[model samples]
Target: MGKDAKRSELGQFLKARRAGLTPADVGLPTDGTHRRVPGLRREEVAQLASMSVQYYTRVEQGRLQASAPVLATLADVLHLDDDQRTYLLELAGKQTPRRPRARAQQVNPQTQRLLDALDAPAIVLGRRMDILAWNPLAAALLTDFSQLTEKQRNYARLVFSDSEMKRRYAGWERVAADCVAFLRMEAARRPGDPRLRELVGELSIEDPHFRQWWAAHDVAAQTVGTKKLLHPLVGELTLDWETFASTTDPDQQLVVWTAAPGTASEENLAFLASWVTTHSPGEADDADARADPHAGRGTPPAS
Candidate 1:
């Protein structure tokens, strides 16, 4: 058997999922019921899963281990999707398997070369959405990674901690939610990752939206997406991004962005690159230039 995950984590995941649903959501008749809590009661969940209230309660309390079938039934009753169900099982330390070891934010030279060869903006992300590395075009397209400290160089921090990010994206909520969802997925995958936990804890305490969104237990493994940026210099830019996982190292991801040919977005990118080359300080490829230090963006308090 794999290393046992914290029973409390399983309990929290189940409670979060349960809180996101109501009687009406599961086709149960609602007769103007006044409930203290926001979602289905423990008894309701037990009834839906055909389990004893005591057993379900014990499972939720992390006092008892949830067998595979019990976990599956609970997942079904909770209406967990593929990614969420996987996360559920991982949290329970049931059928799901985990990587032998967690990885750090180190990229391959060949991968870096490939990233540099791309004309479009690109970033290499770690398991927790950390900005492991980024190319010149990426720096030009987004905030310069070098300008940020390690803790600030994260999607969640950038999306919630920085006001600039809100003005940067056209659909800030959707994108920020996606970022939160992705972090949730990683949380289950790396339940014991200290850095990942610190990232979540920091966001949870500092950002109210992050705290609420995290409690919803949403999970996402989006490989491709679109981001409409209201770029300050070049105006609006519509870019499509693709994430490629390394064949050699699953911990690292290569995310590349591109705009459709003949679109103004593409022209904007070209002009942006030229501006970066001509006006920006330091080497285009070097992770050096600019300064944007902000408070409360440091690493999570030492655990």
Candidate 2:
């Protein structure tokens, strides 16, 4: 959608969510008298958010563009949870889609070499979260994306559409939200990429949860975090994760996973790494390699 349309939609969403809250919910006094509006007064919101009443009114009217920090402050004052916070930011045009520069025709050989050298699981992801390249260790640590067809290599798509993702990650909800947030940020960065639009369309149709999450319009920058993986062969693993921007392809990112030293989860990750190397395909150069290898291998991709 165009920025204006998106802003209007976001504004409506914020108003609806805000109106649903009662003053007492946030520990404010409610007179219990007849009311024209359901929520706190605009002045009350402006005071709490450290904004002027006129400016807050302009924002609610969709006539002002708010800065990121200001929107964040307003979200906090509004008692917005993650989803609501995202919605507020989007409404203020803080998360508009971006126009990406043209992509290179070929992946860099040096990048491939770097992936091959990592003992920790690491994959090179396109701006839209496509699994552009991964090493054997990376394949072992997570799902074997290198074995998938070109069309099936997207991480965001897999999380939303593939059932296996739910089973593979114990903290699927948080992971899913973060994935959505990342994609939202990417959308702002590369708004013109047709592939990104297609991925969003596909996910919106295939998954109800994705449809709900997409409405929030959240965006997140890459940072170190933790993830829990339930490997079919090796049990559970809690891994520390980091993401780095590719120097050659700044739009793409390298996501790496490592477990804490001397932990049982680290040991489990070690076992799973060995398991993926032997079973997952080293590359996707043929139809046979791209075919669904998970057939009868495990439960239907999460559920």
Candidate 3:
């Protein structure tokens, strides 16, 4: 649907739902006078949602883009059911049909085992592009996932915010553009995701390049691709990468970077693996941390 039409529909839905509710129904004390309009007032909804009346009015008038947290709060205040909540999100252009919430950052035990068995660098990615888990080789090839804080583990954030990332990739522009496009696709699929919104907001302010690319409204999915990575220890390596959707959790993906057998890239990858083993036992501990099977999921807010 067109953005304006969808927003109009959203406004109408909000107004209709508001008209059907009463102050007492939502635990609010109603004035004992005869009312002019039906249902709870806009001020009441704004109060319930812990937002200003002007903001709520603008939302009901289709003049503002409601964030995911705001929508969730509104859903609660309005006592919306699952279907109605879904409908509200869809109307606000926040979610799509059958799109689940972003996956937690905990990799399952079996998945961790599979990651450890992989010969190439393999990492699991959450829906919002967070590095949920990575093998030791992955830590060597990419950044050490273990060393990064939970918020810093996001691929898009690293692409735009970390200066070292630009030097690490031979085709920096292509890689950054692709990451931005993939993030755009994710935003479209889950507009109410506060963490995703936060990532975008931070990148937009911090990186003008990201702001321009994001405004272009390009959308792409991350799948099989090749990347030219300049490992500090080893020279340049051209690696073919593939992404596999997790069978158990659709929101999680397994990303593996490999080189063709007998190629220089393969030798370089082997060298990197060996280098990781010899240089960083602490990194190996990070890999073992991934196997804990009880790591808590870290949730960063969007707003």
The candidate maximizing TM-score is 3
Off by over 4 Å in 1: 1-103, 281-303
Scored against the true structure, residue 4 in model 3 reaches a CA lDDT of 91
lDDT of 2 by residue, 45-135 (tens): 7876778999988777777777888877766555555555656665565773332446543458998898898888888888678888888
Question: So what's the TM-score on candidate 3?
Answer: 0.62
Q: Itemize residue pairs with steric clashes in candidate 3.
A: 194-302
Query: What lDDT does the true structure give each of the candidates?
Result: 0.74, 0.68, 0.76
Where is the poorest 10-residue window by lDDT in model 1?
288-297
lDDT score at residue 73, model 3, on the 0-100 scale:
86
lDDT: which is higher, 2 or 3?
Answer: 3
Q: On residues 40-93, what C-alpha lDDT tens digit does candidate 1 reach at each position?
A: 899999998998999999999888998888887787677665577777777676
Candidate 3 local Cα displacement, residue 270, angstroms: 1.2
Task: Compose the digit string of candidate 3's lDDT tens values, residues 1-303.
Answer: 899988889999999988876654444544469988898889989998999999999999999999988998897777665677889998887764554544456899999999998888998998789889888888766676777898999988887777656766887989999998898788666645657656776776687677778767778898999999765555568899999998888889999998989987788778767666566624433343233212211211111
Kindly indicate the candidate among 1 and 2 with the higher lDDT: 1
Model 2: residues >4 Å from true position, as ranges? 1-101, 276-303
* lDDT against true structure, model 1: 0.74
> Candidate 3 at residue 97, lDDT?
55
Evaluate residue 266 in candidate 2 and report its C-alpha lDDT on the 0 to 100 scale: 80
